[model samples]
Target: MAKTKNVRQTALEILDAIEKNQSYSNLLLNNAIEKNQLPSKDIGLLTELIYGTLQRKMTLDFYLKPFVKNSKKTERWVMNLLRLTLYQMVYLDRIPDRAAIHEAVEIAKKQGHKGIAGMVNGVMRSIQREGLPSMDTISDPLDRLSIETSHPIWLVKRWDKQFGFEKTKEMCEQNLIAPMQTARVNLTRISRDECLETLKEEGFEVEKSPVIPEAIRVLKGNIASSRAFKWGMLTIQDESSMLVAYALGVTENEHILDACAAPGGKSTHLAEKMDNTGEVVSLDLHLHKVKLIRDNAQRLGLGNIRAITMDSRTAGERFEKEMFDRILLDAPCSGLGVMRRKPDIKYVKQEKDLTQLSSIQKDLLGTMAPLVKKGGYLVYSTCTVDEVENQNVVESFLAEHPDFEGDSSFKERMPEAVQPLINGFDLQILPQHIGSDGFYIACLRKKV
Candidate 1:
């Protein structure tokens, strides 16, 4: 029989993989849990340890630095182990500090020499003896916030400039929170009320989303395992993302294009909104991702969606100009807005990535602009709140393309509750505002 790894050991291995291989924390942790076939309690502990360690990495490091005199000299795995241990000690109220220290030492001995184990024991003992350094001592406010929130200093500075210090601080604090699980009801097959009733019947604590009529927030229970999701009655999606298809406002028999569609959440929602009558052409850059769109469509019983593998930048070459009644450009973005779910993003993303992503977003808009029929609706959306990738990209596109103008009337079609959040034709839903992943949606209309 294979050795049964404890939660801390599993967490250590995951943290090591994340640092050594540049693996995503969520993906790696999930893969590990599934591979190990861990029970629910252990899985929960592993999740908490992995995500909490990654979420409070900088802060934990700040506390660990003074103890480990030569942090630079310490092995990467050792540093990660220490970070994981300290994370549990500082944040997890349930786990006793002595237990955390003992586990760290044991894991260190298993992975490294006795000297290393001794080093781990000494460092953890010192931390318990003397509490962490005061953040108030950090004179620079940005540095303090960055360390306190476990965000990169450069990102904090940028956000401070974009939104004032107080607002940025709130946003950073919000990023540390785990987002609520939200699912969109497939109204073509099941009404929102019916879906909510079914979920409740299955013992799930679900509530209607305040922003979108089709969305429901799951307060408890594994929504993915529910009968509603398995039967295609609900789609696991963020409330902010569910608004993209609504922003398009497609009608029956109206052709729509989902440019850069993949994993088909928005495309599937678009088809559902059309009552499964319109031709929804979904395009993706990769063949594998195109298959994902097909799978989602088949599962949802949505026949109107046609999946194709084609790059959005070259969409004009394959598709006729002014062909579709509506177009959705769910552009790729920095993904800063989703850090709560994917804490690894905070470490991997850099300031330079924003410039590169904005360039690609503008290119996608310019490339797909001609595909919209004259006076047709085109919705550009991203799972990010950065103005450079959202509002600025739309502003730049409108400046160069005189044939299209911002559509301010788009809000009238959205749920009444969300109408006030719309700015002109664009909506920037910050995570703190609605407890949803940060997303930006802009609607434009081609000139007749």
Candidate 2:
């Protein structure tokens, strides 16, 4: 279905927009793929080129510096083209050097004059022939790791302080890797075992999720377009995100609230866990996203969910105190844990953003804490590894609200794969841990 010609050119355009227009790589790439109707093979190459170049930007630039005399003076599109070519030369062993170099030269000539085309050809060939510069040349260990791993130095230092130097290095390395495509089984339609058998019969390669019993690891093929997915037997989601519903520990016929729910991933899971007997009041800030939640619920044939368009902060005023049996505050954060999936976060997220996000996270925690009935649980989660967003925010809320205390009972709902990650009453899953997204979940209970 994809236009076979000019695939590399498509990737180059995407890389340029990602930096020039401050566009998100994943979102832009998806839009391009959908708009162009790319075939699966072209999709694979396009995805690899865009993500590999962005994930290893600094490293590729370092390798190209010696060859390009006017590195900074180079045009943005030309720079992007060189980086994409260099990424293939360095990381993609399957792509031969000559083909990559030729394509870069051709793209350069098409997009610019012969002069820039010659320069692009020279840079790519020289890098391939001369080999990359050694990262050891950098004096500071932090700087060396940052450049080699293509992570920002400030973020690296912060993680180094939060999680020791060794752990930070491992986490940074893990962030460059691609995440697995995971899906959750809709138990309302079929059991996990039955679903797995069905998928196998349909020629899909899959395995049970280590963290979530209801999830499966999509080893091959796009699970979203699978027959099971179209039939509403499963939904595409990461095991780490699916863990939230499991941690909520829903049973039949209980009232629950999902603050900041959108697209209804966790809300639907909570409803299914309740066997469609209880109501899951899902709240989102945007009306379109609320519609998306409702659409997802209807697609999955789960009618127990009630989607609402309201900010969680105003939820306190609208709903009675202690109205919900359980509340989930999956607050927005710096999104540091999800860097592997969205590498653009490495360049755009600053230390100031973290501070602002921490404040918002704290506010959401305090606002949602009261909504949980006494003896009920409030789970605070984020797809980030930062201490300020996870531990510090939860600790601040616990101190301010004497009625709320850390709840350990939630662990009973956890699988054995994540038991070692338990810290006091919370669980912090770093990227290196089990190779999932960097996620944090803390459980709090109302004491009075």
Whose lDDT is greatest here? 1
Clashes of each: 0, 2
List the pairs of residues colliding in candidate 1.
none
Candidate 1 lDDT over 250-355, as tens digits, reads 8899999999899999999989888999799999999999998998899899999999998889898999989999999999999988999999899989999999
**Model 1 bad stretches (over 4 Å):** 1-5
- Candidate 2 runs further than 4 Å off: 1-5
Q: Give every collision pair in model 2.
A: 2-38, 2-39
Q: What is the lDDT of residue 75 in candidate 1?
A: 97
Worst 10 residues of 2 by lDDT: 1-10
The CA lDDT of each predicted structure is 0.90, 0.89
